[model samples]
Target: MPVSQQRPLTFFGVAFAFLATMLGTTLPTPLYPLYQTQFGFSQLIITVIFAAYAVGVIAALLVTGRWSDQLGRRPILLGGLFAAMISDAVFLQADGLGAMLAGRVLSGLSAGVFTGTATVAVMELAPSYLKRHAALAATAANMGGLGLGPVVAGLCSRYLPDPLWLPYLLHLGLAGLAMLAIWQAPETVTRPERIRLRLQRLSVPTEVRAVFVPAAIAGFAGFSVLGFFTATAPAFMGRIMDVSNLLAIGVVAGLPFFASTVGQLAQERVPLSYRLPLGCVILLLGVVAIGAGIALASLTWFVCGAVVAGIGQGIAFRAGLGEVVAASPLTRRAEVTSSFFVVAYVAISLPVVGIGVTARLIGLQATGEIFAALVALLVLMALVLLRRQRRPVMP
Candidate 1:
């Protein structure tokens, strides 16, 4: 197909593949409560299980982060999809806590590989006539895929006869289809022979340093919001509020990502100077609502807070990412981007683990209040920094 003709299919393929990878990541969201009951684990262990996936993601980003740029997008994506398939298999056969952890680890590995590579592929595959659409493809595939994951898994778990088995089974089918689509897609890398296997050290170079510090901190704060949903929110819903509906849980978990998508969509209208600061202010509102929900033990407050905070996370996260990507030199784009991801994943992992600790010591509700306060303070700091600096004129 001509480049111009490839837009629709490229968007579909990239979006489909992106969602498949994220579905593998969140496939276990609604199931965490089930695992707690089945394996008789503590809440801390649930947080630990989620953290294990973050470990896999960070590890993969550090070691093979730029492999796609070298070896070509197709092989890396194919491997990612295949890894997701194995992860689904692990979930399907999970009988113990170890198997569940193993499945999550593999799922994270799949996501780690796919996130960066598939993003570039989507951009590269855009039709010549629709070249400008690549940005939308990349952003939508990312945030949209994340939002779709829990929704898809949640629906399957609620309606399907065997909740655990059926969700993975459905995901397994989706992964297989994604794999087929990827395999048949055109190879964008021209001189495949020049590519070589190499390990990447995740580092922020001198050139990226000036912009890297604030950008990374902003990313950390934004991703911490995601950490709340992916790791702690569902447990909060069930344990504190006594709500146990799988679909409802999924919706709550998905709200931030959906809001993030909205943030990205609204990016064009919002000035860069305003995006981060305004996003932080909105994020603070979310933290407040979440804290309120926990204190009052009200599900309504929790859901509302999630939507508001999610919009903030979406706005600030994209702006921070855009600044970093735009600032980095072309040759170092992938490495720098991977470093940003490393920072973001760490934000997601470490904070949630800390919350688990606080929940154990103080109480889940109390810990939630503390977490919200800390995040709110962080956003305030980001805003302070934004105000101190002069705005750069956009090209």
Candidate 2:
């Protein structure tokens, strides 16, 4: 128990659990084409299936987001891993569209539970010397796991024996291991003997609204870019550009998330006041590049844009989150953090779903270009709002 309670070990252990859960969520990303092919569904159904994940996430955040503050961190973390395990099992046994939808929603629930809980848990568990660096560690695990899922799943499906079954099989094994590892980690929250569970009603304190609003706005726009890459980019590669190799598609599509992970390294050195606005500027450039790529049918431009936008998203994500978390009261930290993610995941779901629908009407290429343009416009708006402030947003 004493060994299990060691700060670094517990910190890393929970972070690994966070990574493992997220990895499962994205495992289906590169494989979506296969599922469409196997299930004989249209592209619209694919996007809807992906959007279902956000619905589940929003629901979980609204319902159980605060439970971690009431219950201990370890149990909530374990619950999320268990949900991921079930999601993997659903995918393993999936036979039709309904099953696929179910799996995605379950995957979203797992992610929703972990995103805020694990972020705070790892930060809380970090030793004093590493406190400032803990946010990078936590956020990197998230983006890193997201980046790895497609590559790992793509590889297993491409080279390994079974395409659909093998990736989930490997993840299931990892989830099991993650559960055991997390069980040994110490709980960061002090638990009450009589714990009462209630739904989390989302609210930002009057004082935090200033920082929270701008941060959420940046997150919403940046995450919309990520949503496009995660949900529609693969289809664009295969259908529009004629890139058919699952490995190539996965590698290309996963580039933004990988870039975001790298961006976190640099954000650690950036000043708190400068991070959000600077990130917004970079994100705008990246989205515009992506728009041009779609208009010109150039994959290189798309990839370039992805890297740029990812870096901006990473910087904004860490900066916004650091400011919000630091400002939140100790009792409500998880709730506010969960609320921030609610906005981020909403960006992930709704805009991409709109793209999916719009693609059916106007076509994928045009829809992607329009989406990029709109995201760039949104970023500009956020920057304008940030510029209007007389006092610096962050202290």
Best by TM-score: 1
Which pairs clash (backbone N, Cα, C closer than 3 Å) in model 2? none
Candidate 2 local lDDT, 93-189, one digit each (tens): 9999999899999999998888878988889888888898898789778988888888888898789888899999999988998898788877778
The RMSD (Cα, Å) of candidate 1 is 2.7
Tens digit of per-residue lDDT, candidate 1, span 22-81: 867876777788888888978888898888888888877777677886778898899888
Note the Cα lDDT for every prediction shown: 0.81, 0.85
lDDT of the structure predicted as candidate 1: 0.81
**What TM-score would candidate 1 get against the native?**
0.93
Model 1, residue 358: C-alpha shift (Å): 1.9
What is the Cα-based lDDT of residue 216 in candidate 1?
A: 75
* Predicted model with the maximum lDDT: 2
Residue 180's lDDT within candidate 1 is 79
Off by over 4 Å in 1: 1-7, 391-395
